[model samples]
Structures are given as C-alpha cells and as structure tokens.
Target: MRKLDKNLTETLRKTKYFLLDLDGTLYLENKPIGDMKNTLKFLRDKGKKLIYLTNNSSKGAHTYVEKLKNIGFYEEGDLVYSSGVATIEYLNRYYKGKSVCLLGTESYRQEMINGGINVVDGDRADVAVLSYDTELSYEKLCNFVRAIHFGATYIATHPDVNCPAEDVYLPDAGSFIKMIETALGYTPKVVIGKPNNIMGENLKAKFSENDDFSFMMVGDRLYTDIAFGKNCNFPTMLVLSGETTEDMIPSAEKQPDFILESFNDVKNYF
Candidate 1:
C-alpha cells in the first residue's frame, strides 16, 4: 500500500459517510478488488455508514443491492443509490406532477413511479429524462428526442459516455445524450449525477441535517467520482483498482484528497 499523508488519516477517521463507487472501485465485472469485503467490514465495524453510489441508471437500487449481497459486500444498514434515484428526487423537486418520458429500463420506470413521478410513454411529455437504458429501443430513443424537441425539459441522469467493463466499455447515458443532441441540436438542461452538484445537494439534504456529518467519496474515476467529491466539497479518495493508474494522477483535473493502491489498502490505515 502506498503511504497516504497524515491528513488522509484524520479525514478517514472523521468521515461519517463513505460514498463508494461500485464498478472499478470496490469491484470490477462482479469481482471484488483484493480483499475489499474485509475492508468494507472494517469501515462498518468502525461505525461508518456505507452508501454505494453509481451513475449507471439502467438498473434500480434493488438490482445493485442483490449483486452486492451476492458478492458479500452488503449488510442490512448499507444503502445502494443510483443516478436513477437521484434523478427521481430531482424530478419530484422541480417538476412535480409533470408528465415525464423516461428512457430507462422497466425497473427504473417503476422507481420513477414509486418516487411520485408521472412516467409517460409519448412525445408529448412535459419533461424528458434520459438514463442508461439497458432495455433501450430505437422507438423510445426517437420519441425521447422528439419530446425534447417538442419543448419538454431535457434532463440526463449522468454524463458518463461509457461504462467500464472487463473487456470493452459499454455506451452509457452520455453516449445516448450525444445521439439525442445530434437529432435535437441541443443538450440536456440539467444532469443529475456524479460531477454535478444536484446529486450532492440531494445527498446533503437527505443524509446530513446541518452540515455536522461529513462524507468521503471513494472511487476510481477522476472526472466523475473524484470530481463529484470535489464539487460537493467532500474528501475524495481515488483507488487504483479500476480505469485510473498512478500515472494519471498528475493529469487529472479534479485531484483526489488521497490515493490508495486499492480499497484493500484502506484497511491498513485502520
């Protein structure tokens, strides 16, 4: 494990919430990164709250929860939060009772419903939300573009153009956003996930009462995870278990508060 600065130790000890990124941080393609389960157990045993955060909106929290449980990374008090849930909260706050045309999976649509959003299916929607729709259909894609062109408010779940994989990267919501923008000649008015302050604001609103509790964002991505933590004014830790490497640190626009060889290294400090 690389030796982290003394401030990192103080930060880790004081953090009340650990906002963890699943892919490329804790695990990759369904496998945990070197003894990560024990690392998470160490954090939990220290009375820290765990919140698994992801920008992929293709599947709802339940899907991620099940996956985490199967991989032995989840416990009763741990929470799974995706960009879809953040988007749902964003919609209910700003466009309450408005008809939304969501380009997401059926499970994500149900999450919208559960969050009190009036999910619709036509191009006449009052708001148009685009997510990483694993079940995306060409018809739905065209309709979303048309709806945005028809003057519906455009919103995106996140700006991740590609999702990392063991083999090749998969096109995420940002890729679809590019396609939609090509058709409409415009972009989303708001994006509600990592690297955006909306998600941070929502998290702050829900988790912390009066800025007493502190959050620590640990992830593998510079533009998303570390950037989100920086944008949210939270301590950030970049793990090298994913897409980023030691060489990438100097070039990262949003630098992390600390760098760890992997999530497993975190246990060493404890």
Candidate 2:
C-alpha cells in the first residue's frame, strides 16, 4: 500500500461503504483489471461494505454476477446493482403497468419483465426506453425511431457515450441517444442512472435507512461516475484504468477527491 496522508487516512477510517463502478473501474469487458478480489476481501475484513454499481443497462444482476465470478471478483454475498435495476424502480414508481418499448439487450428485456414492466414490440407503447444494447439491431433501431415519432415518452437508463472493452470502446446508450436526438430533435424525458437522482433514490431504498455509513464512490469516468458521487454527496476516487486521464481533469466539470493510476494502486492503500 502507498503511504496516505493523515487527512485521507482519517477519511478512510470513517468510510464504511464503497460504491464501486464496474465496467471501467474494476474490469473491462470480461477481463479483470487488478487484484480486485483480494482488495475487496481486504476491505471486507475491515468491516466495509462493497456494492458494484454499474451504468450499463444491457445486462442485469444475474449476468453481472456470472461475469464477475468468471473474472474472480464476485462472491455469493456481494451485491451487484445496475442502471437496469434503477430504471425498473423508476418505471414502477412513475409509469406502473405501462407498456414499454425497450431498445436494449434480450437480457435487459427479460430483467425488465421480471421487474414488472410490460415489454412490448409495437409502436403503441407508453414509454420508449433506451439502454446500452450490445445486441442492438437495425430493425430494433427502426422500431424505436417509429415509437419516438409516434410520441412515446422517451427514457434512458444512463448517459454513457461509450463502454470500455479490453482493447476498444463500444458505443453505448448515450451515443444511440445522440443519434435519435439528431434525427427526431428530442431528448429523453428521464435518465435513470448515474448523475441522476433515480439511481440515488434506488440506492437509498436498497440500503438500510438507519445505518449512517460514510460512503465513497470509486470509478474512472468523470461524467457518469464522479459526477454521480458529487451529485449524491459521496466522496469520489478517480482511477485512470478506463476513460479518464490526468490531462482531462483541468477542464472537467466534476472532479475526484483522490486520483490513482488504477484500482491496483488502491490495493496498496489497504
């Protein structure tokens, strides 16, 4: 572990929970980024709670669990939370029992159905939800555009432009959103993920109300991850393993409290 200043060490002492970003901060695609399992175990041993928070809404908790397990970072008890879960919570709260046209993966659609959303195929949907659809097809794109033109209320799970992979970045939900906006001249009515209050509300509902644990958000993206932490009043840590770089920090609208080369550097702190 690297040496920590007194102030940072004090803050660490008070922090009882870590809200972790998955895709960029911990791993890229199917590959692990660091000795994450041991680092998590180290934090666990210190009586800290860990929750994997992700903005990728294409996959649900089950898929994430399997992926994490494959990368050797997940255990039976660890919680995996995603924008899809938050989006479902938002839908149930505001648009309960409404017909939804989802532009997402098959897994995401199934998860939404399981969460009580009425996923439909036609243009006569009450809501048009967009996600990071890795399995996105041209036919699906046409259908979604048709729904938008037909006046279905638009919603997005998150505003991430790209999702990091091992070697390249895949265009994410935000990129799709920009395309739609350019074609139709409209934006989403609601975005339910990071840097949005819906996810924060969902987190509050998931965690115990009585437990006043000091929290920190650790991630790589300045917009989604760091902005989310700032918006929700949690301390933020920026990792350079993914989307962000040191040169970009000067002009960033949102900034981190601490910066590290990668999550591997974080392992040293413990």
Whose lDDT is greatest here? Answer: 1
Q: lDDT (CA) for every model shown? A: 0.88, 0.83
Error of 2 at 91 (Å): 0.6
Instruction: Please report, as a residue range, the 10-residue window in candidate 1 with the lowest summed lDDT.
Output: 207-216
Poorly placed runs, candidate 1 (over 4 Å): none
lDDT comparing candidate 1 with the true structure:
0.88
How many backbone clashes does every candidate have?
A: 0, 1
lDDT of 2: 0.83
The local lDDT score (0 to 100) that residue 50 gets in candidate 2 is: 81
Off by over 4 Å in 2: 1-3, 210-213, 265-270
